[model samples]
Target: MKHYPVGVFCDFDGTISKSDLIASIAYEFAGQAGRDLVRRIQRRELSVREGVEAIFRAIPSARLPEITSYTEQLTVVREGFDQLVSGCIQRGWLFAVVSGGLDIFVHPVVQAYRSEIEVFCNHLDASGEYLSIEWDVTCDDLCDGGCGLCKPTVLRRFKPDNDVQVVIGDGVTDLKAAKEADYVFARDSLLRVCREQGIACTPFESLAEVIPTLEQEVSL
Candidate 1:
């Protein structure tokens, strides 16, 4: 068997969790306004940053805690996430969550793997009555839809020069990041784009399937 140094960067919302927490927050907290903002984003009419900001900003700042709690309670992270994280560590592979989403909700969901998974995402200012992103990691010009933090840039910064880069994601925000990877595992909207663009990829429905595939790729 052949071995390659591996670095895995995964999208947070739909890939790791059964549902997109941002959409949950927007629709649950922001109500009709959130629905509208999400619709625009889905249609590619709004930049991700613009749509995300508008969605959260529509909600009262006081609900930040409520949103966080709700996300944790309602979101179901795919099965085998624990084993996948353990498997990566056992193989000495780097693992990270590179999300185009906010930390307000992501923190609660992914905190369980804080020791093993490095998380890179945007922080939101919920101190006011509405939510707006505070970009700690800025998006690059390659991003046309305003992903506040470009996942590809984050991947480049963390992945070693000699290591093989792998990306797993499920949405439009993941497009640039998935393209930068040497091995791609895509699903949902991201999967559709990868197919259309002729990008080499593996499609999966759950994290349970991802581990074996990664091991297979690393073997040769």
Candidate 2:
């Protein structure tokens, strides 16, 4: 087997968890307004940053603790996540969860592997009466997506020279990262977009299926 360095940048929400926690929490807390914002995001009527900001802005700051608690209880990491993280560490591969999700909930959900893999995401602020987002990362000139955490920027910064850039994701948030990847593991909307754009990719429904495929790629 050939020895090569690999960088795996995976999405958080829908890809890691069984569902999109952002949307789930939005609808649960923000109600119809949250649903509208999410719909606008899907239709490209609003940027992901804009939509997410509006969604959270609807909820009171006091609800943050409750929200965090609910999110932790509700989140379920995808199968093979730990295995994948372990494999990467063992193989000297870089595995990071680069998400458009918030730090509050994202951190709690991935707390088990907090010391293992790197996580890049946005922060949630409850300083005022209503919650707001604090974007610690943003899109560079090369991108126009207005992604809150800017996955592409994270990918570019972390992707090492001569390393295979692999991206795993399942939504619009992953689109720019896919364009930057040498290998892509896609599903759902991201899969459809990949097909439409003619971007070469491997479609996967779960992370379990991704493990063998990724291992084989790096070995080759």
Candidate 3:
């Protein structure tokens, strides 16, 4: 085993949480319209930002509080999240939660680890008739647009020269980030996409599985 600095970029929606938060919110509040939009996103017919915006737009701005409350109730942090964070800290590895989800929901769920890890995500505005997304990050020249927070951009920004870049994700949004990483821990759709793309990666169902794989590689 060799020792080197490693940067871990993890997805939030389906990876850290037990389920996809945005999709859940959309289905619960936005109704059938939301389901259709989500399907379009899955099919790559619509950009992620477009699908998310369309879904939230269908829900009136007045329901923001209800949406937030619902999000909190629905959020269940996946097992081994804390351990993954701790492993990164102990080994002096850089760890970031790079989510395409909105801040309103992403914040509340990851509040416990706020001070420990860096988080990059989009913001939601409920000042108008419907919810609108505000982006702090956009796709770079290396990538085509669609990603709201742009995980690959964040991975490039945080991963230093000579350091190994590891990406962990479970959805379509994680695909681009996986391409940019030196190592990828993928599950579900992301795993399928990676295999299809012929990108070498480790398949994992839990963050716990990721920890030992990383530790073993870095000799930590």
List the candidates' TM-scores in order: 0.90, 0.93, 0.93
lDDT of each: 0.79, 0.84, 0.85
Residue pairs with backbone atoms closer than 3 Å in model 3 (clashes) = none
Stretches of candidate 2 exceeding 4 Å from the true structure: 1-4, 217-220
**Full ranking by lDDT:** 3, 2, 1
Candidate 1 lDDT score at position 192 = 93
RMSD vs true structure, all candidates: 3.1, 2.8, 2.9
Cα RMSD, model 3: 2.9
Per-residue lDDT of 176 in model 3: 90
Q: Provide the lDDT at 76 for model 1.
A: 83
Show the lowest summed lDDT stretch of 10 residues, model 3: 154-163
Model 1 segments beyond 4 Å from truth? 1-4, 141-145, 218-220
Q: How does model 2 fare in lDDT?
A: 0.84
Clashes of each: 1, 0, 0
The residue-level lDDT of candidate 1 at 179 comes to 80
- Could you tell me which residue pairs clash in candidate 2? none
* Model 2 TM-score relative to the real fold: 0.93
- Output the number of the TM-score-best candidate: 3
lDDT of 3 by residue, 1-220 (tens): 2333888889999999888999998899988888899899999999888888888778889999998888888888888888898888777777788999889878886788788778899888999988888986898888888786788888777655427888999999899999999899999999999999999889887788887887687543
